[model samples]
Target: MVVATRELPASGYALEVDGRFKAEFATRDGARAGAEELKKRFPMLQVRIYDALTRAREDVQLPRA
Candidate 1:
Protein backbone atom coordinates (compact mmCIF):
# COMPACT_ATOMS: atom_id res chain seq x y z
CA MET A 1 0.00 0.00 0.00
CA VAL A 2 1.14 3.59 -0.64
CA VAL A 3 2.19 5.47 2.47
CA ALA A 4 1.98 9.15 3.45
CA THR A 5 3.12 11.15 6.47
CA ARG A 6 1.87 14.25 8.21
CA GLU A 7 4.56 16.00 10.29
CA LEU A 8 3.49 17.58 13.51
CA PRO A 9 5.02 18.49 16.86
CA ALA A 10 2.58 16.32 18.75
CA SER A 11 2.38 13.34 16.44
CA GLY A 12 5.79 13.87 14.86
CA TYR A 13 4.63 12.05 11.78
CA ALA A 14 1.14 10.74 11.45
CA LEU A 15 2.00 8.00 8.99
CA GLU A 16 -0.70 6.63 6.75
CA VAL A 17 -1.27 3.92 4.19
CA ASP A 18 -4.16 3.88 1.76
CA GLY A 19 -5.33 7.15 3.31
CA ARG A 20 -5.50 5.58 6.76
CA PHE A 21 -3.30 6.34 9.75
CA LYS A 22 -0.68 3.67 10.36
CA ALA A 23 2.05 5.07 12.59
CA GLU A 24 3.48 8.15 14.25
CA PHE A 25 6.86 9.83 14.64
CA ALA A 26 8.45 12.56 16.77
CA THR A 27 9.79 15.05 14.22
CA ARG A 28 9.30 16.10 10.61
CA ASP A 29 12.87 15.31 9.65
CA GLY A 30 12.56 11.99 11.39
CA ALA A 31 9.40 11.31 9.44
CA ARG A 32 11.21 12.25 6.24
CA ALA A 33 13.88 9.74 7.12
CA GLY A 34 11.26 7.12 7.79
CA ALA A 35 9.64 7.89 4.44
CA GLU A 36 12.99 7.26 2.81
CA GLU A 37 13.06 3.79 4.27
CA LEU A 38 9.44 3.25 3.31
CA LYS A 39 10.33 4.09 -0.28
CA LYS A 40 13.07 1.53 -0.19
CA ARG A 41 10.81 -1.22 1.13
CA PHE A 42 7.84 -0.24 -1.01
CA PRO A 43 9.53 0.74 -4.23
CA MET A 44 6.25 0.81 -6.10
CA LEU A 45 4.50 2.90 -3.47
CA GLN A 46 4.63 6.69 -3.70
CA VAL A 47 5.41 8.17 -0.30
CA ARG A 48 4.93 11.85 0.64
CA ILE A 49 5.06 14.26 3.55
CA TYR A 50 2.35 16.59 4.83
CA ASP A 51 2.35 19.39 7.33
CA ALA A 52 -0.08 18.59 10.08
CA LEU A 53 -0.23 22.12 11.45
CA THR A 54 -0.76 23.92 8.14
CA ARG A 55 -2.19 21.03 6.15
CA ALA A 56 0.52 21.29 3.52
CA ARG A 57 1.69 18.33 1.54
CA GLU A 58 5.15 17.69 0.09
CA ASP A 59 6.34 14.95 -2.19
CA VAL A 60 9.27 12.84 -1.12
CA GLN A 61 12.19 13.07 -3.52
CA LEU A 62 14.50 10.13 -3.68
CA PRO A 63 18.23 10.43 -4.06
CA ARG A 64 19.72 10.20 -7.56
CA ALA A 65 16.23 10.56 -8.98
Candidate 2:
Protein backbone atom coordinates (compact mmCIF):
# COMPACT_ATOMS: atom_id res chain seq x y z
CA MET A 1 0.00 0.00 0.00
CA VAL A 2 1.19 3.51 -0.80
CA VAL A 3 0.25 6.70 0.95
CA ALA A 4 0.63 10.29 -0.14
CA THR A 5 1.40 13.29 2.04
CA ARG A 6 0.56 16.77 0.91
CA GLU A 7 3.24 19.42 1.41
CA LEU A 8 2.33 23.01 2.19
CA PRO A 9 4.29 25.95 0.88
CA ALA A 10 6.39 28.16 3.13
CA SER A 11 4.67 31.34 1.99
CA GLY A 12 1.15 29.97 2.22
CA TYR A 13 -1.53 31.70 4.23
CA ALA A 14 -4.25 30.20 6.36
CA LEU A 15 -7.67 31.54 7.28
CA GLU A 16 -8.78 31.07 10.84
CA VAL A 17 -12.19 31.62 12.38
CA ASP A 18 -12.70 31.62 16.13
CA GLY A 19 -9.27 30.09 16.63
CA ARG A 20 -9.98 27.26 14.22
CA PHE A 21 -8.54 26.90 10.72
CA LYS A 22 -11.17 27.37 8.02
CA ALA A 23 -9.17 27.51 4.78
CA GLU A 24 -5.74 27.81 3.21
CA PHE A 25 -4.53 30.10 0.45
CA ALA A 26 -1.39 30.47 -1.66
CA THR A 27 -1.25 34.20 -1.00
CA ARG A 28 -1.99 36.52 1.88
CA ASP A 29 -4.41 38.56 -0.22
CA GLY A 30 -6.41 35.47 -1.04
CA ALA A 31 -6.64 34.52 2.62
CA ARG A 32 -7.61 38.07 3.54
CA ALA A 33 -10.28 38.12 0.87
CA GLY A 34 -11.72 34.88 2.11
CA ALA A 35 -11.77 36.16 5.70
CA GLU A 36 -13.52 39.35 4.62
CA GLU A 37 -16.24 37.44 2.80
CA LEU A 38 -16.82 35.17 5.75
CA LYS A 39 -16.95 38.17 8.06
CA LYS A 40 -19.55 39.79 5.87
CA ARG A 41 -21.76 36.71 5.93
CA PHE A 42 -21.26 35.99 9.63
CA PRO A 43 -20.75 39.23 11.52
CA MET A 44 -20.44 37.54 14.88
CA LEU A 45 -17.60 35.22 14.03
CA GLN A 46 -13.98 36.19 14.68
CA VAL A 47 -11.90 36.07 11.51
CA ARG A 48 -8.10 36.05 11.11
CA ILE A 49 -5.26 35.40 8.69
CA TYR A 50 -2.30 33.28 9.68
CA ASP A 51 1.13 33.40 8.05
CA ALA A 52 2.87 30.08 7.98
CA LEU A 53 6.32 31.59 7.48
CA THR A 54 6.25 33.94 10.42
CA ARG A 55 3.99 31.78 12.53
CA ALA A 56 1.83 34.78 13.29
CA ARG A 57 -1.88 35.48 13.36
CA GLU A 58 -3.44 38.72 12.15
CA ASP A 59 -6.91 39.68 13.33
CA VAL A 60 -9.35 40.88 10.74
CA GLN A 61 -11.29 43.96 11.77
CA LEU A 62 -14.87 44.41 10.71
CA PRO A 63 -15.79 47.33 8.54
CA ARG A 64 -17.42 50.38 10.07
CA ALA A 65 -21.18 50.63 9.98
Say which candidate scores most in TM-score: 2
lDDT of each residue in 3-39, candidate 2, tens digit only: 1113333568887778777677878888888888888
Model 1 spans with C-alpha error above 4 angstroms: 1-11
Off by over 4 Å in 2: 1-11
Q: In model 2, which residue pairs have backbone atoms overlapping below 3 Å?
A: none
- For 1-65, candidate 1 gives per-residue lDDT tens digits of 22333434343455554454555666787778877888788867666665566666566657765
- Could you give the C-alpha RMSD of every candidate to the true structure, in order shown? 5.2, 6.2
Candidate 2 Cα deviation (angstroms), residue 64: 0.3
